[model samples]
Each structure stands twice: as structure tokens, then as C-alpha cells.
Target: MAASFQVISKLLGRLSPSISHPLRQYLSCLQRLPVGSRPGLSPFVPPSRSLCKAALPRDEDAAQATEARLCYKDSPWDYLESEDYIEKYGTNPVWESYRRNHKGGIPPQKTRKTCIRGDKICGNPCPVCRDPNIIIHHQNVKLLQQFISPHTGMVLDPTRTGVCMKQQKKLHEAINTAKNHGFLPFQIPFVEFSGADYSNSHDAVGSTPPPQSLTSGETWYKWYSEITPDENEVAKVKKTYKAYLK
Candidate 1:
């Protein structure tokens, strides 16, 4: 009976070691992994759909809030009319006021009255008025040439020319019209000179004879020859003027 008990005890010891070995290995693997690494485990809990929807912004509400404080501004050309210009600057020649104001800062705007009033009566004389009969027209090539620089094809500035804004505008328009019509001379012409004769003697210098006179071809007008005056005719004119001189 004692021998049978010993054999049973040995068999039980062998089974216990095999079961414990696998359990120890599994526990060691679990310890090495991060807290939330296990599959099928809920690491985080999401908020409700109602809370998420409340946090979003409405696009229409933001757009409406920004629309009330805006305003439109007019361009510089918009002040070309007499009324708008008068409000900003008084009736005065643009060129005169431009020079005065420009001394310190930028010039003021030119009103219609300033350009309309003749320079003789008006306090200021604009660039256009200083020269008479300087009409700004497409046909007026001479007038247009004055506004443009001969050296450079650039248009002269209002300050340099002393012209009012109105005249400047008209001048620019005339120049453009002339250019379009092919009236203005765009290209400058070239000229060539022959070398001078350097002969020493007066006879040698004057050796070239007078050009040969040709016959009056296709005679339209009468040609008169040199008239020789008599000595007696000259004595009568001198005697008549002698009494006036005394």
C-alpha cells in the first residue's frame, strides 16, 4: 500500500510542472505590452453626437455680421467734373496751385472754373494761355509738337509746361489723334555734309565759276536783263533831295 501511494505522488508532481510552465510564459508576455495594446479593448470613450454638433460654426451668420461696415470709394477720374473738383479745390489754375502746393507737398485738384477763366483776368496764367492761338486739335501739328520733347518722344509734364489739367487732357487727346491719323512726324531725318575745300590762294579758293544760266524753259514770266542807269538821271535825284536835307 505504501509503494502504491509513492507512485501516485510522483505522477501528480510531473503534471503540475507542465501546467504551471505555460501559465508563467503567458503572464510574462502580458506584462511587456502597453496598457491599451490589447485587441478588442475600449481605450477611449467618445462624446455624444449632440455635443459635437453644438461646437460647429454657422457660415451664414458670420457673413451677415461682416457686410454692414463696408463702403465704396470713387476713382481719381471721377473728380473730372466741375462740381466734384470745386468741392475739393477752389477755382484756381491747376498749374499755379500745383507749383505752390508742390513746394511743400502734393498739388491740389484743378476745377473747371480754373481752366475756363482766361489767364489775363484770372489770378493765374496756365501754360496753354501763355502762348496764344495754341488750339488743341488733331490737325494742329505745330501746337502738338510744343507739348512733346524733340530730344525724347515723351510728353512734357504739366509742371514743366505749366498747363492746366483740362489743357493737358486736350493736348494728350490731340497728340493721340494726330498719331492715329499719321499726321505727326515720328522719325527724325538724317543729313550728310561734304568735306570743305582747303586751297591756300584766293584765286584757287574762288576758282569755281558761277553756275551756267539756262534759257527760260516753258516761258511763263518775262525775264528782264540788267538795266544801266545814265549819269544825268542820278544828278536830278540828288539835287531834288538836297533841299530836304537842309
Candidate 2:
């Protein structure tokens, strides 16, 4: 519309003075009047490029996300001790309130193989995978303790904890590592010892008799030595290997 107006103005300016003088005066009068009073044109408001730019995530937000991942990766234990942990789960395990999304009242027999498949993540992912801050590490004993049973001291099952199979495997490995490194304690079953346990007098512990095979380089059992291959099979074997048997 602005281009059309400019073209008309130029055409008028090039015409003979008789017609162009009055039109030029009218254009000057329109320019002097407020934009709102203009007949065919509305206000020329600037484009909202700033608002569009603001709608995108800032560099600081990306940096913060990177920093958060690094924090969890480097020292996951710190997140367990941080105020954020307390606020999100005050004195409760990470999986305490988590419920697996399933159909009907009866739950599925097994948890998902993995919460994340490549670049895609399934809805209602397991607690461990859902939170980037909850990193699984052998050194993160405090976090590992949450998945363990207080009474039994055993790692909680995936069915009870609603953890995906992949995360459950990771939890098992981390817990095992923690126990091996003395960060976590494992219960050792106690057995009553008897004096005979250390003794070598029992018949079971006595020296075994030498087998006939070792004594005479013969087959161990009479049946093994007595059996012979069928003549037809022997002939077939010989014929098949005739080229290499020599």
C-alpha cells in the first residue's frame, strides 16, 4: 500500500504544473496532519522483533543447564545434600511417592526395559531417569541408600520402586560397588561352626582310589571299552576321510 502511494505521488510530481501543483499541496497537508487522521494509512508501528527474540531461551539458561549436569556428574552426592533435594523430597526416598503409569488396577509384570530409547524418552519415565539431578554413582552412597530396604538392607525391587530395568541394573551395580568399597554395609549370614568341620577324619575327605584308566591307560568303565562301532559306520567314516585319514 505504501509503494502504491509512492508511485502515484511520483506520477503526479512528473505531470504538468497545472495538475501537479494542487496534488503536491494536498500531499504536504496530509504529511503535516497526525497519522491517526490519515484516510487510507494507519499508524506505522515498528515490528516486535525484541519480543520474538526474548521468547527464545537465553544463553544463561543453557549455561545453567550444562552446569547442573556437570554438578550431578561430578559430585552427585552434593545434590543429595543440597537444599533442592530437601525441598523436592523432604526426608523421603526419591521413589517413595512415585507410581508407575499403567492401565487398570493391575500393574504390568515388568518395568520398561529403559526409560529413554536413544534421543526419545517415554512418558512418565522412571524416577532415576526423570530427574537429571539424581545421578547414579558408586560414590553417591546417600542416593544409593534410598533404593535399599531399611529392614532387610537389600536393594528394592523394580516392581516396588517403579524403576525401569536399565536403571535397576545400574542401581544394582552402584550398590554392589558401594558395598565393595565399604561405603555401604552388606549382611553376612552367620553359621554355627563345629570342631569336625576342620577335621580330616571323615570318609568324604579321605584320599580317592586311583581309577582303572589311570592305572592301565584303559577306558574308565568296562562298558566303555566293550562297545564297538557298527561295521557300516566304520566303513562310512573310513570312506569319507579316505583322502585325509593317511
Candidate 3:
């Protein structure tokens, strides 16, 4: 009977609340923790809300945008067809407007290499060439003036004016022809002195000596005086000759 009672006591101790209470408490604590949280793992941390927002563009980006806007504002060829250009300038040498706009700089477009139909070997043809009827000549004074500087009287370079070699040659010829025809003014005349004159008259201007004497030293001349020599003057000559008289 005592053995059975002790066995019953052991079984009851095994089924006691000591283990159950600890396990229940552990489960309750686990449920209370956040879903993202783990005991030994790092806690859940999201990026800051400020960092998640998009950043504004920097100064460089804004500058690029401005430049793009400026680039698109006007086409490079606008001056070609502007009516204001025609009125402000004139039709005498209409191309002057275009040259003025692009002076000291290259045009945006390249000149054509040959005639469109290949009938002729044109070195460089401008925009007007493709459309025909635009002629260049010495008579076009205004156009030629644009190529020449008003201050220095020198022709502008091809790189600055975007003129090809062939056109530049023609332009020079035209300028010369214009000058010959009085359409362009020739360069102002300059004074230059030739070498100095060294003639005898030039040397005598400030001479110190009087005119040369009628007779030089040791020269003989017949006397024109009427009176003969005096006795004393004749005797003096005889006395001086007495030593040779013997």
C-alpha cells in the first residue's frame, strides 16, 4: 500500500503547474513582441521619411536646362529671312545682313561642294546658290563692304566669314575690280621722300671762301699799266744783278 501511494505522489508531481506556468508565460511574452522583431536578431528599422523623398535638382542641372532653353529659342538661320533686316539694311547688297550676323564667326551650315547637277565645278556654293538668282559681283558694293573692314581697310579671313577658298578668290577679284571702278575707295596716299641731292650748287650754299682769284700763284700775265718802272725800282734790280756782271 505505501509503494502505490509513493507512485501516485510521483505521477502528481510530474503533472504539476510548475512546468505549465513557465511555458504559458513564455508563449504570452512571445505573442506580445512585434512581428518583425526577433530575440537575437537586429530590430526592424525603416529608412527615414526625409530620405525617402525625392531630392531637388542641383545648380548644374538647372544651368543645363537654361542653356537648352536658350539654344531652342531661336534658329541660327532666322536672320536670313527677317524683314527687319531688309528694312534696317537695304537691298543694294542684301547679303550684307547675313555677313554682319556671322562676322568673325562660322555659319552653322557647310557650303556645297559642287553644282547641284554637276554641270559645273563650283568650289563653294552658299545657301542662295541652291535656289539660284543670287549673284556676287563688284557692283554689289554693300556686300563687298561687309567683307572689308571699315577701319583697317583689310579683307576679313575666310574662317571668320565662312567663305571657302574659291569664293574668297572671287571676292578678292571683285574687291579689286570695285576699287578700279571707283566703287571702293583706294587707300589714302602717303608722302615718301627720295634720296637727298648732292649737287655742287647744294654744296656752295654756305661756302666760307671768296670767289677764286683771277690769277693763281706762279702764273704770268702781261701788264696793261701805262707807266714804266721808276729808276730806283730799275736800279734795285741792276744792283741785285751786279754780282753776276763780272
Task: Give the whole-model CA lDDT for all candidates, comma-separated.
Answer: 0.56, 0.86, 0.57
> Highest TM-score: which candidate?
2
Error of 1 at 230 (Å): 99
List where candidate 1 sits over 4 angstroms from the true fold: 1-113, 117-121, 130-132, 187-246
Instruction: Give the local distance difference test score of model 3.
Output: 0.57
Candidate 1, which ten residues in sequence have the lowest lDDT sum?
68-77
* Backbone clashes under 3 angstroms, per model: 1, 0, 0
TM-score of 1: 0.29
Cα lDDT tens digits for candidate 2, 1-246 = 457668768999789999998877877777777878766633435666878788667867878878988877888899988887899999989999999999999999899999898999998999999989898999998889889999999888899999999999999999998999999998998999999997787778967767543566577676887888899999999999999997
Give the alpha carbon lDDT tens digit for every residue of 1-246 in model 3: 335435544555576588656645654565577756626312325556655454444566777656644653444233323454456555543333334233355554543333344576344444234223233577767567777877889887654555555666778998999899999997876978655544444556646766555654432334634457799988998999989977
Residue 227 Cα positional deviation in candidate 2, in Å, after optimal superposition: 17
Question: Could you give candidate 1's per-residue lDDT for residues 1-246 as a string of tens digits?
Answer: 335435545555577778756645644465567757633212224656767676455555555434321211122223223353456444543333443223346664543334455434455557555323234677756556767888888788776656777778887888888888998867656767545445444576666777666676533333434445678988898798988766
Q: Any idea what lDDT model 2 has?
A: 0.86
